[model samples]
Target: MTQDATAVAAAKVAGVVRELTARVMQYDATRDRRAVFAYTYFRLTSDLAANLRTNTLSFREPEWVADLSVTLAAAYSTAMDAIDSWLGLGAARPDGAPGGEVRAADMPESIPKPWRDVYAASTVRHSYVLEEVLFSMMAHMSYDLPLALRALDPAAHGDLRRHIADFHRMNDLLASSVDGVQDEISARYCRRLHSLDRLFTRDDELFTSYGIRVARGMAWFNCHRLLDPDAAAEAQGSISRSTAAFIAEFRSPDDWKRRHAFRVLRALVPSRRQWPPAGTPPA
Candidate 1:
């Protein structure tokens, strides 16, 4: 892509990030559990957009990365827009229908399954914040990512190996974002996450970072499968099955022990005395 084209792509990412930030703020004001994931996503995308603007990572194919980011962001925004329309949240409908309303009966078939699950879980007050974040991550990384990669068609770009390298380079940003993301989650939702982080030996970070790395690796592998004529259907089916299984584990009643432990920790840790002002930029 030409320099002008890269600039255009970067500008598109910035616009999407701004829109997402507004959505996140709306969710927070409503005390919606969806805010947990929305905030995390806002931070990640903001960081990516900032990097793209500054050429901070010096990505080999910066335009491709910017375009991929925009693609994934669009998918997420589309799903959210559908859900918002269904729930009467006042967002403009994607279909341009009057009053931004979607019929309840049409909602289930309209939204992607993983996102459907995420929205359902968000309505449950007892759902774990971390699990909600993971649900969003899994939906985007495991389900949306391969499709984005396939759509971009790296082979058609240039230097396939360089594209792959740039992809793995994202893991570094993910790893670095872990602590700040956890801090934001704690500030916004659960005060006791710090204690739990200690109880888990900071393995929470290890688990999250490692899980994201593995998920991205699988996404890359699945992208290859998606590009293959014989394997695309099977690969997509496998993605759906695995994502469903992940959501199921988080929803199971058998996880009471962990929930009980969290309750205990909540009792032990003092609540945050002060929250960052609304619209404060994430660290």
Candidate 2:
């Protein structure tokens, strides 16, 4: 399917993700706010640009693309809130102010478990940069996008096939972009020393960590499932339970091998302050 020329024409904007990334990076440079999340956003935007370039740009319908693009940008905005807070530049919790907060704050309740769980995990813990990026993607794509779609049009969608295509196509693009994203992340945050390939991708199914491919597929399934009037409640409950269970593991110290490894890696690297009060904040 050729991309909807009309969507781009009407909005007077293209490459929304690309543009947002650029602006975020420029902010980072200007303020020298090299917060860890900044690099995560960089990977996200770069991967999104790759997705648009190679897979869905020409095929996705403009409306869907616009929705997904805006959804992503909104998620990025919320993330920036956290980043800015960490830099002492601003205060915005992932589940706080910002329109996306409505969708996020209601997670695992009004929305799916993945979104709620991922956000909770990230916020509650001091995680690896990879966890920050991946969990944010998990929550935004898996929850917010679908929830936003339902809100935009509550009518039962007849375009399941198209939705699935777009969803899977984006996933594929992310899978392909993983290596490159990992490279950029490692270079900047991981001391430009250790490679995170094995820790992240692991060469399992679809070239990602074990079960993530299936998890992503499930996220796609849940999107359609959430739109079903009858099934929506049950789906939300199931997602909530599963997400809660996964999050519970983090609460226990025994289940911290992954977190421990990341800590060791980060500690091995020399201390590098990302941001240290650079004059007055930008106006």
Segments of candidate 2 deviating more than 4 angstroms: 1-15, 22-42, 46-63, 75-126, 149-154, 192-213, 237-244, 250-283
| After superposition, candidate 1 runs with Cα above 4 Å error | 1-9, 89-107, 154-162, 196-207, 251-283
Best by lDDT: 1
lDDT of 2 by residue, 1-283 (tens): 4444544522522455445555545554553222344455456555555454444444455456556656656655655445444435343244333322222354324324464455555543233445545554545545555555555443667455556666566566556666665555555545421333344433223225334456667765776788788889986676556644443443332436766764565456333323324332211
Clashing pairs in 1: none
Model 2, total clashes: 0
TM-score of each: 0.76, 0.59
